[model samples]
Target chain A: MEEREISKAVIKRLPRYYRYLGELMENGVERISSGELSSRMSVTASQIRQDLNNFGGFGQQGYGYNVKYLYEEIGKILGLDKKHNMIIIGGGNLGQALANYVDFEKRGFYIKGIFDVNPVLKGLSVRGIPIHMLDDLESFIRDEQIQIAALTLPKSKAEEMTALLVKYGIKAIWNFAHIDLDVPSDVLVENVHLSESLMQLSYNITRYEKEHPRS
Target chain B: MEEREISKAVIKRLPRYYRYLGELMENGVERISSGELSSRMSVTASQIRQDLNNFGGFGQQGYGYNVKYLYEEIGKILGLDKKHNMIIIGGGNLGQALANYVDFEKRGFYIKGIFDVNPVLKGLSVRGIPIHMLDDLESFIRDEQIQIAALTLPKSKAEEMTALLVKYGIKAIWNFAHIDLDVPSDVLVENVHLSESLMQLSYNITRYEKEHPRS
Candidate 1:
């Protein structure tokens, strides 16, 4: 499919489809109809069919979809079938948490190293990925052919580190920094703003209170 | 405005607007036209006007918006102006990371306690918030009037813990567990699927490669 044909909404929902199908596969479900999958996913059957059709329909009209087959196909489309080397650029609490995250490898992201300027964290390791000095980041990225850099740095350091990573030829960034980074249009960034999400929860709670006032 | 009137899409974007306006305020940007704000935000001026209009338009005909006033208005709409006491359940890596996170307090969610099933983790303190035994979760929530529960537990524990939290009167859950929680309609949950996002970055990288092939 051409890039223009695929909408941002569709691309965003691709991961949700990938996740739900993964669960079904793990549960040993062999097949599922669009309607059944839709019920499980909280999306409409037609919408589900439409999304899958964008990448060539994996579902059969009568036989439904082979769960494993569909999962693999979606995984392939998501580039999850091959390993992508990654590095965490900060060794702070959040960065250390991510370094210890076990699911990234299972989803085909191999964290090659963790980097920090702090002297105390230099020799430490989390889940076998040793913390390397920030000085080595450029050489490491080039040497390992690292494709993604996970920035867990402070807001003050985010822009500089992002530019450094882009300069060293990293193509994508999973940013956990509080601030946004300005990058060329070619570089992909997925900003995970924890505060924004917490605020959403705050809004929901407030809305609920206003709707269902205490009697 | 009534709960029925506002769309979820608008609710989701409130934090983004809040964040952007905040940056402008910090930079000493006193006032901004929708067109200028739109340029900085990468959103159209009409869309910005529409979003702000939901809560009664804050901008004037020619003067545009006062950055501080707009920021404060958005904060009020998002319920970020009031303090919401919270607890972090499951004192694991992710939970600990969040417990140490300073931004939540700055944003109005004050984490009062951390709970864990592990005996070793119990009685430990992170950022001065003690990790209490999981058994005390019920009483702690009641005593603290905790409005939010940040769940960073393993998937196996999510459902049971969610039920417990709801029973103890948790209004919202910020779930980091890989699995979806079964909650009542009134109980709000915002699932943060880390791997799904990583997959998105992977897909983007692949798309970039397809678009700009190495010669």
Candidate 2:
């Protein structure tokens, strides 16, 4: 498949589409129209068509889209068809949670190792993945060919850890740390700022309260 | 201050702005120009100016923006100045991690209680907050006047729990379940799909590998 530069907006929504389609497939739905899929997704029908068109629209004019085919295709587009070896940088609560998140394994992301600074947690394991100390990180990344590293470390340690990860030739980082990382342009970062999300929710709640003042 | 409808795009950037301003304040930066802030944030100067402009443009023509003032204003806009009481609907690893995350309390969203279906987990405390059984959920929510609920339950229980939460008057939901919840229009839901994030990472890795295929 010829890959053109898809907009970040479209790329962001692909995962949701992939998920909705998977749900449809699980419910035994064979095919669905753009209108139907859009309603299920709460996205506009035209927007769905346009977004799908970016990756060569797989819809038949009269028949709509094949649910199974669309699901598989979108999976391939999201690069979930291949296995990815990843490691968590801090084996704290968040790191352990990510390591134990069964969905990652289901989607082809294998937790090869977990690294933490704490010596007490060094020998511990989460979901059969051993937690290794920061000292062993360099050789482990090289030997295991770790493709991604999740930073669940403190903000103070984030930069140093990022530098170490980048030095060890890590490709992508799923950072949960409070600070924004300074990495090479080649390294992709997807930050999961829980506080930021909480702030957004707070904003929404405030808006709702103001708009619907109690009697 | 009068409130007007702010664009979702601009609202989305507010958190980043808030964080950057916070970092600046911590670094003893009392003021910053749009260009300076833009360089720090990686957002365009014009874009930063425009986004802040939505909240009365807390900037001077040449003197630049008062970082402390802007930070406080953005914090107020995000409703971070107010306290919010919340509960976790599932006491799994993800739920425990969220409970252990101290940043939420600093942001004024307090985790008052954690509810779980598992008898083994019930009565266990995470960071001093006790994990209660599903039976105590209703009374706890009502008694505490809980404003937010974080759903960390499995997909099978997500819908049912959402129904219960809606019935008991949960204002907002931070859903970590794989399912897209069906809640009332008044109830807000922010989904954190771990698999979707991994998929995005996978897509980026694929793009990077394609763009810079190792020799």
Candidate 3:
């Protein structure tokens, strides 16, 4: 088993594992070893072994990870064990979608609030969550105990707002702003550049089609 | 140099390399070999070499890679060199924010249109791109040669919409759905699961704080 100081890369891999495991559970898959997971996810068995080791060695020599147990542990380590209070910083469509995101609650996270700098959205309610002003971040974070703040502000505003959120003691940020966030070393900043992901997909699909012709 | 049939995984690393290279460039680093870049990005040196090999060998035996050229070549390989007609499907907050995304233009892609099923957003414009109807997708892609799409639809609708887009001859998709997608093996689907990204960030930051503490 590995320590709790998980590698950032390994942590990122958790989502894929979560999704994969969720499907495996959906299909009534009872147990899975690291090798089975590695084959399905296209990651190495040893890599999965190492990643699993961080939380606690769950895999046995002959038997692999218990699919349910591994899934539960991964969820716990990723903070899905307890309901996470989430707030979106921007009240735009991204914020609305995030507010309406069903997987959060299904995985034990809650949308505490969604806020924007725009004065008009202050009183508006989207998906039953009252939109609030940016000024309310500190109070809301403290009162709601928002463990994750989705930063969906504009390009020019990302850095500024991220700093503001950090001041309010937001632990982690899911930044959709296409800007390079300059956050404190202590705060976790995850930038989701949607376009870059698409570009990669396009390039790969083009190449895949060429190789397979008709898959 | 590697063949055009590079693993999607290797191609995905290009943008990160480009981003890191930009940082190194800004810091006035002239040239960097694979070993140096691998260290900075916390990846293996062979990985750096293999990834770069996908876009032609960018390194020299003695000197190293020409930073600017390497970045440019990567941009080209990722289709960042050509002007891409981009559309944001499901004109929600994420779509609106993406329409206003500042980096796309700078990076050589353009948001030509945004469409939503919501009639309220119909004919409305975000950052100058007129929001259209969902029915307009096929026509627009044909007429405008839309090479890419950013789909931020609801999880329930995500797979269906993505399949539709790929069927409509969309070369690539940037999916922001919080669900796993099933795509044709040849079709490219790059998912940016916001929840997953946040989970990784949270656990990794937990690790970073525990290890470095002060840096």
The residue-by-residue lDDT of candidate 3 on A139-202, one tens digit each, is 8899988878887777668888888888889878888776666777777777787656766765
> What tens-digit string does per-residue lDDT give for candidate 3 at B138-202?
99999998877888788778878888888898867777777766666655667777777767765
Specify the highest-TM-score model's number: 2
RMSD of each: 1.6, 1.4, 5.2
DockQ winner, 1 or 3: 1
lDDT per residue for candidate 2 within B148-171, as digits (tens), equals 999888888899889999999898
State the lDDT of candidate 1 residue by residue for B133-207, as single tens digits.
978988999999998899999888899999999999987999998887889898999888888788888988887
Can you rank all candidates by lDDT, best first? 2, 1, 3
Model 2 DockQ (Cα-based) = 0.78
Q: Could you give candidate 2's per-residue lDDT for residues A168-193 as a string of tens digits?
A: 99989999898888999999998888
Docking quality tier of candidate 1? medium
Please list the residue runs of candidate 2 whose C-alpha ends up more than 4 Å from where it truly belongs after superposition. Answer: none
Give the per-residue lDDT digits (tens) of candidate 1, residues A111-189.
9999999999988899899999988988999999998999988888999999999999988999999877899998899
Candidates in order have lDDT scores of 0.89, 0.90, 0.77
- Pairs of residues at least 3 apart in sequence or in different chains that clash in candidate 2: none
| Worst 10 contiguous positions by lDDT, candidate 2 chain A | A99-108
